[model samples]
Target: MDAIRIQTSAITRPSINLHTNPSGISFMKDKLLETDKSVFSVFGPNLGHYADDIIIVFKCEISPHPDANFSIQAATSFVSGNAFVLRPWLGKDPGSLDE
Candidate 1:
């Protein structure tokens, strides 16, 4: 598995406005319809307390076979010398686990 990092000063910013409609369900439905074949979710530190940055971990399928294998990948951020670094990883699938 490979790990990547993404850093930004706006970590606390809101990416999506779930209150677009009187009922929050509408926004979610619209988002789901816009989604592509691959689905992903975002995770971060717990409420009240926040981390210095954010990290997103996911896997990419590299084969078209029904039993296609997946490669582990991550997107996160880190603090450098007075600056933040953004790193991403897209590696080749490691093949089936039964191998």
Candidate 2:
């Protein structure tokens, strides 16, 4: 599971009345495509701002293929590409609330 926490304060410019820049807001769409071109080839209903934070959970069969795991790719890209602060956390399991 890959979890990313974006700091809203960092993305906003206080000088601009705390309103997010239109270009900066749109930057994620570009980055999403760049980061996961294979995953989001068409930019259909798969993408949206369903929540404040982005959490991608991948469930795949354990395979010998090295490329099967792209969690690192997603995490690294988000961290390296953005100037704003983003807290990304990677875990083997998305712990249950009951536990």
What's the lDDT for all of these models? 0.31, 0.37
Badly placed stretches (over 4 Å) of model 1 are: 1-33, 36-38, 46-99
lDDT at 91, model 2: 32
Q: How many backbone clashes are present in model 2?
A: 0
lDDT of 2 at 49: 58
Model 2 error, position 63 (Å): 5.3
**RMSD list, candidates in order:** 17.2, 17.0
Model 1 per-residue lDDT at 18: 22
Candidate number with greatest TM-score: 2
lDDT of 1 at 39: 35
Give the alpha carbon lDDT tens digit for every residue of 1-99 in model 2. Answer: 122224455454443642443232344554444432333222123344531343454455633467753342433234344322332343323243222
For candidate 1, lDDT tens digit of each residue in 73-96? 221111111112222232333343
